[model samples]
Target: MKRQFVTTENTLRFLEGFSALEKRGAEEACLMVVDGVPGLGKTSIIEWWAGQTGSVFLRAKKEWKPNWLLSELIEALGQVPRHGFEKRFKQATEILANKHEQFSMDRRPFAVVIDEIDHISNSEKMLETLRDLSDTLELPFIFVGMGKVRTRLTKFPQIASRVGQYVQFQDVSLDDVLAMAKNLCEVPIKRDLIEFLHRASRRKMREIKEGLSSIERFGAINPGKEIGLDEMAGKLLLNDRITGKPILVTADGFGGDNE
Candidate 1:
């Protein structure tokens, strides 16, 4: 693979927590709130975990109504292949339960991983829908998205307080960035390039990876001896697409970095 994921120890620890929740008794199943900036590898981690455990993965649309969203969930369940209103719901729930003719009391419960949950973070109807499915059928589920989920959960205290684990995923560090850059590009990145990238990316993984690739391409094509800050600036200045000027960034830290 292109090594998009950083796969740090923190991510592994969070996965361990997920596994513990899944293996717990039915009554003890829990929800999770994974808060992070966009493209911080949150979705990738969830997808990888789902793949590793043979669980189903579903992403919440940027905007969705309850019925449309429910249909999307049903579609993800692999039950849309069946026709009709009556058969669809029956088949959907059945497929979600791993197609077991009888719900196994001790069987590993199916994991329903929902991403972009914060889209419906304030919608009680949507929240209640998930809560009802989990409570009535006693299903195992996990939700991943933006914002402080605890605040959103206040709308539904029943669901909010039931969350057994909460984790905020973040970007890969600059130290990890250089190694990933070296590994992916098959070339050593100069310290200045790394420092410039660290400043530009603000420790955001996707931005760092993209910045590294841009620098590597300049190195390969421009006949440059080494990738450095000036070369990177010439080739890929962080310019606002709307304005034709180089972006000026200052880091007083996230507390108040606003220009």
Candidate 2:
């Protein structure tokens, strides 16, 4: 199976939200929040967008202090890290301001995406810094966190109000499953197999990848044959949630036991 990024419904929704927020202009709040359940490809979508737009991507960590965050932002903007928290913060802003100035000439927009924001969602200082940067730079600051991000932001009403767009990702639909299979699978997969894989993986992108890989392996072992649930009925396609290992449930080993 080939590894690739498939544009599902979630991707389109994210683009729409971004376009809407961008249209709101710098006069309004330019912050965007993308909160979704784990394993729903939120990071993937953000990374893709950042790559396309030449945006800076930062991953927040639990141990990140104010200085650390500022330094990261500075480095992401391709500036030399300076000493002192105030200087570093100012340097980061300066870099962004210069970029914004250049953007004015070319009529291009710049954005920054901070992923795993839930790690420091409780840090008032960090959130305040983000708000200040968004206001000062007047550039789009996208926050990517888990499902509770919107609820968590309520603690900072000022920041929450500035959220021009908030996108909540949901589980994959049947069409998403089909699209994923078609993109990853090299051979023609039967509809019944696609349905079975979708349900078995619970529509999670991570598990769906695993299930498709398993199917690919099965197909490789048995070439020139249509893959189906019967080939996988006695084997494990996904891992056990708790143990992180394969869990196979077969009927008495195909009735080999004494009856």
Candidate 3:
């Protein structure tokens, strides 16, 4: 399979949300929330975007406290974390403020992304600290989680009111699956196979990639043939993560057990 990142409708929506957050009128309203079910590619896309934009990305820990978050932010900003929580907080804000100014001058979108934010979403202290930092610096903070962050944020009206954009990742469409196969697969795949994979994977990005890998391997053995549903029949296309069995393509459709 080719090493690539395929832009889908979800990615475009996320970019739109970020653009809206960047152009927000109120400084204090600088928060963005992105949520989706597992296997939808929320973390994968956010990590890719962070790398491209030079944004500081932190994965929230189950036991995260305000001080731990501050320390992580300080280190991510390329500075040594100070001993005391207050000192670390000050350091993080100063560095983030400076970086925000630099990004503004360069016309680049800058944000602090907290992935797995659900871990800390219930902690009022941690959320309050994040809210305080964003409010103080007028910088954007993006919270990425597995479908609950949006509802959880409502508990903190102060934080919820400050959210400038909310992006919910949805199941990939057949078009998105086709784009991924075209960009990431090593060999040509027919529309029939692509559509089958889309349905078999239930439109999940992670499962679609797994199915693509199966097609790529089959294509490699065939050498230059465009793989289709017929060619892929009786082949293992995806693994049933819940059942620990291979899902094989059959003449009529797919089944959890191998043909």
Clashing pairs in 1: none
| Candidate lDDT (C-alpha), each | 0.64, 0.80, 0.89
Top candidate on lDDT is 3
TM-score-best of 2 and 3: 3
Tens-place lDDT per residue, model 3, 55-158, is 99999999998988999899888999999988988899999999999999999989999999999999889999999999999999999998888889999999
Using alpha carbons, what is the TM-score of model 3?
A: 0.95
User: Could you give candidate 2's per-residue lDDT for residues 112-224 as a string of tens digits?
Assistant: 89999999889899899888888987788999999889999998898888999998888877799899878888766676677766665656777778777877887887888
> Which ranking of candidates, highest TM-score first?
3, 2, 1
Residue pairs with clashing backbones, model 3: none
In candidate 3 the C-alpha lDDT for residue 23 amounts to: 86
Q: How high is each candidate's TM-score?
A: 0.75, 0.89, 0.95
Consecutive 10-residue window with the lowest summed lDDT within model 3: 250-259
Residue-by-residue lDDT tens digits, candidate 1, 59-83: 8775776566667778766645455
Better of 1 and 3 by lDDT: 3
Between 1 and 2, whose TM-score is larger? 2
